[model samples]
Target: MRFTAPVDGEPVGAAITAEPLEDHFGAHSALESALMAAFDNGRNPIRSVCAESIDQNGGKGVVLHSGLFRVDGMEPDRGITA
Candidate 1:
């Protein structure tokens, strides 16, 4: 898959590539399984399975998009607690 960032940031509009490999597929599959389990526990999957596929590739999926867009217009200052 080909990934491109917008022109506003450093290395903007750069095309990122995900090499089709077993490792990537495995990571994606594992993430999907975890997501399904989370759903079973009454939690919603954070992203779709295909998006997760992009994640395991190299774009890191929706995270890159979220940081760039900031739908609520807020920066994540605290970072990840864990």
Candidate 2:
């Protein structure tokens, strides 16, 4: 997957992960494990996310965005999947 941070249509820092989600393991068990790892490690931090998911989750949860992140928490919104 690819993303571009634009400043008047310019690109900035980017990350490339092959089998990214495979490492991520969207499976329930894997997700839970990852959450535990990140939360317990105290390394993950809040990131710049599209406001739409924040609007949808409404503090009940948050959906991870396709931007730089260390991994904290996220939810799912139909068109706003993260």
Candidate 3:
């Protein structure tokens, strides 16, 4: 996943899975900074941003919540298998 700040045209967040044993460091902080840049610290603040998570009970979900994101609802069979 990649997040960019349109106001300054800068990349704010990125996640790369290069190796199975590689740990995800600074992901939460990066995402939190991205959200803050998009929603809080700009002249043209975005009203909302939508994100989807495959595992709602996992680390991604926890990071989202830390950025004040809430679960709107779930869509059944929304993944590629559907």
Q: Give TM per candidate.
A: 0.20, 0.23, 0.18
Model 1 bad stretches (over 4 Å): 9-11, 17-78
Q: Each model's number of backbone clashes?
A: 0, 3, 0
Clashing pairs in 1: none
> Which one wins by lDDT: 1 or 3?
1
Q: Give candidate 2's error at residue 60 in angstroms.
A: 30
State residue 55's C-alpha deviation in candidate 1, in Å. Answer: 20
The lDDT for every candidate, in the order shown, is: 0.30, 0.34, 0.28
lDDT tens readout by residue for model 1, 13-64: 2221122111222223335454334334321121233234343456433333
Q: Is candidate 2 or candidate 3 better by lDDT?
A: 2
Model 3 compared with the native: what TM-score? 0.18
Predicted model with the maximum lDDT: 2
